[model samples]
Target: MTATMRAVVLREPGPVENLTIEELPVPEPPPGWVRIKVRAFGLNRSELHTRLGLAEGVTFPRVPGIECVGTVDADPSGELVPGQQVAAILGGMGRTFDGGYAEYTVVPRTQIIPFRSDLPWEVLGAVPETLQTAYGSLTVGLDLRAGQSLLIRGGTSALGVVTAVLAKQMGATVLATTRREDRTAALAEIGVDHPIVDTGTVAEQVRRIVPEGVDAALELVGTPTLPDTLAATRVHGTVCFAGMLSNQWIVRDFYPIGYIPTGVRLTGYSGTSGNLPPEVLQDYLDKLADGRIEVPAPTVYALDDIRRAHADMESDQVIGKIVILPISGQR
Candidate 1:
C-alpha cells in the first residue's frame, strides 16, 4: 500500500462544504522539485476562486492552499539539505499542482526559499503569501520609495494592514481607508498618518487629506474600488491591484484608454513567483525575526476545521490571516 497523508481536498468545485479532510498519498518531488513537510500554511482569496472554478485551467478535486512555511523533507538536487526550514508561495501552487492544504506538498526546488527563523508556526505560515503580495505591490508595482505618500484603499483587510506597516517602515506617509468609520481609529494605531472612512467619495476624501492626491495606491478591494484608487493618485503616480476582497474580478465597461489618466500608471501584482520573489520573502523573514516588522497573529485551526475557516473568511469579520496546522487535531 502507498504511504498516505491527510489533506483538505476539494473533491468538486462548489461551496465551502465541498472541502473535506481526506487521506491522500504522500507526494514525491520529481526531478528539479523538493518535497516539504507542511507545518503551517495560509489561506488566500485565490484558493477560494480555485474552489469556485473561477481560476481558469484549474481542475477539480484539488488541494487548495497557495503558500506555506515548512521543513524541506527532501531535496533531490542537493540544493537544500534535508530538514532545512523553508517558505514557498505562488508558483502555480494550488492551481496547477497539489498545494499546502496537505500534510506534505512538493514544488520545484526553485519555488522554495530556505530561511532561518525562530518565530512560531502560526506567524511564519501567515507571513509568506501576505507579505509577498504587499512587498510585490509596493516595491515593484508602485515603485514605492521613502518620503512618498501612499493610500491603501482597503485599510481593514489583511493585505492593507501589512502594506501600511511595510510602507510606513519604508518611511512613506500612509493614508488608509475603510468602508466603516470605526476602523480608521485602528489604522491610526498602526502608523497610518490619515485614515478615511470609505464612503462613496474615496478620491474626494483623499484629496482633502493630501491635496494633490497620494504618490501611489494599493487596491485590495476589486473593481468597484479600482477606479477610485486611480483617481486618488497624483499625476504620474501608480495604482496596483493586489487583491480582490470584494470577490468581483471583472470590471465592466473598463475602457482604460480614456479611464486611466495620462502619466498615471496602472499596474498589478499577482501573487506569483515573479511577484513574490524569493529574496523578498527572505528579507521579510529576517525583519520579522529582528522585530523590525510584525504581522497580526494568525487565527489557527486544525486541518479538520478547514471548512469553517473558509466559511469565516467568506464572512465579513476575519481580522487576520487564518492558518491550518496539520499536526494539530482536525478542526
Candidate 2:
C-alpha cells in the first residue's frame, strides 16, 4: 500500500472549486474499523448539500462522499478478509469523519456490507446507497404491496428510477415525474407507467391519471412539492419523504389538520446500513447480473473531474446518478 493517496478535500463550504485534490496519508483502520481500497463512489445530493454549506453538523476539511464500493484493505477484527469486496454507506460518513472521496477510506465495521460481484466498478459504485434508500423507502416507509399504485415525485433522479424499478418488480403500477419532457423516455424505459411533467405542482396531473390519486407517493423533491405529493395520494394511502433534491426540506409553522388530508398518512425514510439486509443487496446484484433489472444509467466521472461532476449535479441537467471513479482504469 502506498503511504499517501489522492483525495478530494473540501476546506470549507462554498462552491465546486472548493473541492481540491491533494495527496494525503492513507487512513489506517482502528480496532473496530476497516480500511477499504476505494474503487468507485457515487456523487449524491447529500454530499452536494454539505459542499454548498446547506447540510448540518458538517465540519470543514472533509472528504465528502456518503457511499462507496471497494475491496477490504485492512480489518483488525478479522470479521472481513483483505481483498474482499465491500460497501460502506451513511453512518456519519463525510460528516463526522473523512469519507470515500479518495483512493482509500476507513469506516467502522458496522457500516461495511460485504458482497461478491464481477460487475465493473462504475455500476457497483452506483448501487449501495441508491439501493438502500429505494428499497428501504418502498418496504419500510410505504410498506408497498404488489398491485398497489406508486408515484415518484422526482422520477429523473437516480433514486427515483431505482425506486420505480423495484416497485415494478414488486408488481406495482408506477407514475413518476420529471420536470423535463425529454427525460420522460428515461422513466418509461424503466417501466414507469405514467411520466407526468412536474410543472411545480403535479397533484392535478396525477389525479387526472389515477383519478382517486395513487396508492402511495415518494417525495424526493422535498418540502416545496410535499403538499402536492400528499394531495396526490388516495385515502389511507402513504407519502414518504425520502430525498431532498430541491435542497429545501424543512416545512415551517406546523399545522397538521390543514396540511394532511383525511385518512392519509405521511412518513419519511432515511436508512442505515442495517436497514438493507445483505441478502437483499446480493439478490439485487444477482438480478442485475442476470438482467432481471437495471439501474438508471449513471453519468461517469474520473477523480480529476470532481469539480465538473459537482457542477453538473448542481445544474440538474444530468438525468441520473453521477458516479465518480477515484481509481483510474476502473471502467
Candidate 3:
C-alpha cells in the first residue's frame, strides 16, 4: 500500500467551500527537488486571492499555500538530512504547483531555507513569509535606518505588526494604523509609538502627529490609500508599497508625474524566500528562543479546520497571521 497524506485540495476558485481536505498519496521528490514533512504553514492573502480567482496563472486542483515550515523528509540530492528544520516559500508555490497545504509537499531545493529552531511549529510557521516580506521591505525597499520615523498603514494586519516590530528593532519611531480604535492596544504592544484609527484621512491624522510627516512610510493598504500614504511622508522620504489588503492595487489611471509628491520616492517590494538571508532568519529564531524579540501571536488551526480558517481570514477580524498545523497535536 502506498503511503498517503491529508491535504487541502481546491478544485476551483470560488468560495471558501472550495477548499476541501482529502487524503492523497505522499509526493516523491525527484533529483533537484526535496520532499518536506510539513509541520505547519501560514495562511496568506496571496492564497486567498488565488482562492477567489483574482490571482493570475493559477491552475485548478492545487494545494494552495505560499509558505510552509517543516522537516526535510527526502532530498534526492543528499544535501538535506531527514528531519532537518526548513521553510519553503514562494517561487511559484501553490500557484504554479502543489504547495504546503498538506502533510507532505515537494519543492525545488532552491525554494527551501534551512534553519535550526526550537520554537513551536505554530510560531515557526508564521515566520517564513511574514519575515521575508517585512524584512525585505525594510532593507531592500525602504533602506530603513536607525532613528528614522516610520509609519505602517494597515497596522493590524500580520505584515503590518511584523513590520512594526522590525522597525522598532531598527531604532525607528513607529506610527501604525488600525481600522478600529480598540485595536490600538495591539499595535502598541508591538511597539507602535502612534496608532492612528484609519478613517480614510490618514494623511491629515498623520500630520497632526509628526508635523513635517514621517521619515518613511510602509504602505500595506493598497492603492486606495496610496495617495494619502505618500502625503504622510516627509520630503525625500520613501514609501514601499508591499501589501494589498484592500485588493485594489491598480490606480486605473497613470499620472505619476502629477500623483507622486515632490521629493517623495515610491517603491514596491515583492520578493521571494531567497531574498531573505539565512543568517537573518536564524538570528530572529535565536532571539525568539532567548526572548529578545517576538513574532505576532498567530491564530493556529489544524488542517481539518481549513474551511473555518479561510472563513476567518476572509472575515478580516483576526489581528495577526493565521497558521495551519498539518500534524494534529504538534504544538
Model 2 poorest 10 in a row by lDDT = 290-299
Residue-by-residue lDDT tens digits, candidate 2, 83-130: 999999999999989999999999999999999988888989999999
Candidate 3 has its poorest 10 consecutive residues by lDDT at 288-297
The sequence of per-residue lDDT tens digits that candidate 1 reaches over residues 70-170 is: 99888888888888889888788887888899899999877787777778887888888888788888888898999999999888777888899999999
Model 1 — TM-score against the truth? Answer: 0.94
Query: Candidate 1: where is the Cα deviation over 4 Å?
Result: 274-279, 329-331
TM-score of each: 0.94, 0.99, 0.98
lDDT of 2 at 173: 97
Q: Give one clash count per candidate, in the order shown.
A: 3, 0, 0
Deviation from truth (RMSD, Å), model 3: 1.1
Record all residue pairs in model 1 with backbone atoms less than 3 Å apart, i.e. clashing. Answer: 304-330, 304-331, 305-331
Task: Indicate which candidate wins on lDDT.
Answer: 2
Q: How accurate locally, in lDDT, is each candidate?
A: 0.84, 0.93, 0.92
